[model samples]
Target: MLATPPDFDVLIVGAGISGIGMAAHLEMMCPNRSYGIVERRADIGGTWDLFKYPGIRSDSDMHTLGFVFEPWKHEKSIADGPAILDYLNRIADERGIRDHIRFGHKVVLADFRPDEARWHVTVELEDGERKLLTANFLYLGSGYYDYDDPYDAGFDFSEFEGQVIHPQFWPEDLDYTGKKVVVVGSGATAVTIVPSMAEKAAHVTMLQRTPTWMFSRPARDAIANFLRKILPEKVAYAITRFKNIRMQDFTFKTARDKPQKVKDALHKRISKTMGNDFDLKDFTPPYNPWEQRLCLVPDDDLFESIKAKKASVVTGHIDKFEAGGVRLKSGELLEANIIVTATGLSLAIAGKIDLRMAGEPVKFDERFYYKGVMFSNLPNLAVVFGYLNASWTLRADINSEFVCRVLNQMEANGSDLATPVLTPEAEAQLEEDDLFDFSSGYIQRGKHIMPKSATAYPWRLNQEYLYDRKVMRKGDILDGVLTFTKAGANAQSPDEQLEAAE
Candidate 1:
């Protein structure tokens, strides 16, 4: 008897930047391979759609963050949530990818059957109904963080009478005009909310336990705007993308190589922006820049708000929540009519889906990341995790392209499965390294759950884009590490096939 075939060649899990990019690549690269995207939410844009907070915008400029194939024609390189969503929507519509997506479907569990060389996925619909779908390959594009729950810092608000909010679940109808607001934390969200809320609020106070390193750049890229006017759209976008990628790489390298110099540069920039109001204690963090991602303040908005006395920063530990506001450990009380917890995100592995291999739960922390795309010993599965130091879409684009190549190679070679096989001998010889070196709260908290990494290439999820681009784009698929085989009784490892060929 013959085994059952999969419904689709590839089942992409998410409608976010990563999934959209993958679908676009498959359309161009592997046109014959049928695929479907199952988005948990009812909309197309993932993060952009979920986050409805005021002044929601892209931390990274759109040139590099935008898809490589798609040219971002927006005037502002650093665009807002709606603009980014529009860009993504346009891509889905123009490329005819929207027809392939099934919104309101959440992937709950996935089990790879080695015998059939297919993945049996269990999807839960929004109406609480469940259905089973099978696919030849599974691609997890459901971003890094938890969508259902943000990280809870365990602040007791029992004593406080004011409305407490988390930025992740911003209330759409809530009004803050003429109200005194307090935003907690010093991360990107807090910095963004502080300035944005200050614009309408009577006064905004940014309360943080520690200061985060911040750098301000114009919201609009003048060079990109200038180029768009003179040069062709594609050519101009390509140039700007190249420039931004190099600049991002250089800045990250400088921060790593010369910490003190980067620190001095950041201090000087912030000092100049804040002028006499700038205090060394409030702006200077104990750690170096890029250790934890630097907060990008567009057009000195945060500083301007502070200068205008519309917003203020308080550096202290929250002792407890009083009726009026948060009381500090330093015996100072910060008053507010509303409190916004700009606390960081909680990381989830494979979108918190129950991933199993041969009906057994797969332990991600025990597995190794292979070529930063797939995991060791995992067959026909690819994950889209972006760069930490650079724009996320950089990694997403490369990953999508690489996965398409793998699918194409499988077709050409008559192989049903491709797994990065790590034999016992090879695994024993490998040296383990921390998957991520950053000291950010979320990264550190979730380090134990992330896949393991080795010091060498192809065994680790690399942080450098320049090196990754060459290897992932041009490297051979049959590199001896990835074992390709057929299904059932005809199955044979790549080594055995090679021996037979010789």
Candidate 2:
């Protein structure tokens, strides 16, 4: 009851890939609505701008990572970080969305007023100035991983440390040149850093407690290149995107359905490339493929490094860190001048902003995701969380489209409030699943802080892109689960939704 009208119609958090895309979507779909973006950094690109480590590239194909509305013109489906950042900035400038972004402004807290159907957002600008702003809708495209907080392997590397570095905070000036480097963990970051750093380092050693599945792919997508040469730009891009998506879908399905067969094929490829002398066990993962994300090596760079002896792989547990380097559980000692902990990212949703509803702190675990975008009992909020199995932007673009649809639907209904609601009994009946079903340590560690996933429709988020494209992008907006209400009243009950549906 203590809430007032909002100044802006919407306020988007983060000015990265998701935020920039969200701005463009709003421009196309909600032209009448006034919105602004607040980014914590002084730059527009988020992750791409943040991670300056060498050899940082897209794990997934860029064709799918690129926004649906905007076609990717480049030949490489998997692009490097700087290229990706440049592409995002180009998008912002071309669309004229760059001006709407207020850099160096971080949203600290957002208090939702159910009565007033508004949000009072607290933002801290550069130079330590805190200010309050209000908006009718809040869209969070801040991304999943936290830049400031990265996951460590709980290594007692506390002692005898020789310039330990995290991929998240890769120092620009720190030189690994002509030094023996040991990169801990076998995730995407480690794999990427191993080869890139080996180019200059005296010798790079990749020490992994457990092996991760790696796929060697060409840096340049041959099929996409052929299509580009033969077909029109737009048509070629559309075809290439579709082909890549289908290929990813097929590969993922094959891995899931026939784990051993897919495993044999993948392991065979690696064993042949790396040669029998380089133990295949180092490339063999205990878990099935696609259980955790697959690591892609462009042009067999990682394998080439290992083959050329520029880099080596050591598979064992770390007993402790000694004076010079790491002591393995197998009684082997790895001597290194520098240690790079390419562990993984710490998941921080909504830029780690506090969400309060009616003066009460909102519990993420207590809330169910609505269509994987909006949280249950949360009004006029959309989150951009992409698919784990496919390209990130595939889901992000659809989520933006869905958010636009929600806004348009509310406008059409003359309703100022829209919230996804479920009966108490129904929510209680739903079974809880991990927000992300992956064996990745970062995801597992952050599960306690993430929102719980449900089993039923409107609550579950399918990882498949085609399914989401059908449901999220083309599904009915008047679904009974999403209740609409105008100002000066409480949200509609289950009976009201049923009656309206009838």
Candidate 3:
């Protein structure tokens, strides 16, 4: 008797940018493959739908953040939450990707059974029903942070009588109109909320322990808008995407090579916006630029709000939370009727899903990252962890396309399993490198959960988007690092075996 085949050739987790990008690639590149997407939420947009906080917008430009297969037709490159959700929705519907999605189903655990060359997946439906499914390949696009929990900075809000809010779980019925609001933190979330809340709140104060590096740019992309009017949308998008990618790479490289130069440039620009006496200490960070992600203030909104006296900045360590507001260690009390904790996220590996290999739980920290796409020694599995310095979708697009190439090659060679196997000698000689060099609180706290990285190529995430794009797209698959095999067969490079036979 013959055995039953797996339900799908590819099982994708999450319906976000990365997941959708993977499915799209499979359709265009490997048309013969069967796939299914499992999203925990009922909606299509993942982060876009989850984050409904006021003035929530893209921190990066849309041209590079958007998928390569689709064009971001909107006038504003720094788009808001709803606009981005709409873009995702249109892409899903236009390509019939939505039809393949299994909404309201959450993947609880995935165990890859190497003997059968398939993954035995355990999923929970919306109604608390557990179902088992099998797939030939497992693709995880489930972002880096925990969806249910935000980072608890362990603030004492018990004594404060006013409403305290976390931006991640912002209530829809929240009413801060004409209320005195104090937003805590100086990261991207706090920077976004202070100016937005200042519009309606009687006064909004940004209370921070330390300052963050920030710069301003116009929300609308004038050049992209101009090109769209004359050229086809795909052509315009291609040109704009290329230009923005180059610009992003240039800025990051310049900041890393000449930190003082970048710092001076930022200081001069901020002084022009906020004036010389506006307290440079509030915007100056202790670390150099690109060490932590820079906060992008669109159209100088945050500075303008501060200049208009609608909002203010207070930098000090919080001693405790009082009835009125937070009391600083400097013995000063900031008054507020509403306190917003725009603290950072609580990071997780592989969406906090339980990953295993043949019943043995996978300790991600022990494994090395392989080409930023798959984990070393893990077969038939791939993940979409995007670039930290550049746009997330840039790496997502490249990773999705690369995975498809691997799948197509596997089929051509009649191989059911593919793993990036490092020899014992290679592993011993590998130099350990930090997976992410970010000093942000979340990255620092979550470093223990991330996979190990090496100093060499194909063994690290390499945060350099341009270099990764070139190598990932055009590099040889049979690099001898990735070994392919049929079930119950000896592992070897398929091309090598073919040459030996010839």
Candidate 3 has what TM-score? 0.97
RMSD of each: 1.7, 2.4, 2.0
Error of 1 at 310 (Å): 0.4
Displacement of residue 217 (Cα, Å) in model 3 is: 0.4
Residue 176 error, candidate 1, Å: 0.7
Winning model by TM-score:
1
Error of 3 at 403 (Å): 0.3
Cα misplacement distance, residue 146 of candidate 3 (Å): 0.7
- Model 2, TM vs. native: 0.96
- In order, the Cα lDDT scores of the candidates are 0.91, 0.86, 0.90
Give candidate 1's root-mean-square deviation (CA, Å): 1.7
Query: What is candidate 3's local distance difference test score?
Result: 0.90
Better of 1 and 2 by TM-score: 1
- All candidates: TM-score: 0.97, 0.96, 0.97
Top lDDT model? 1
Could you give candidate 1's per-residue lDDT for residues 1-502 as a string of tens digits?
A: 1365688999999999999999999999999999999999998889999999989999999999999999999988889999999999999999999999999899999999877889999999988999999998999999999999999999999999999999999999989999989999999999889999998999999998899999989989999999999999999999999999999999999999999998998888878877755686887898999998999999999999999999999899989999999899999989889999998999999999999999999999999999999998999999988999999999999999999998988888777788999887998999998789899999999998999999998899999998999899999977888887776643266556434433
Query: For residues 64-101, what per-residue lDDT tens digits would candidate 2 score against the true structure?
Result: 88988787888777799988988998989998898888
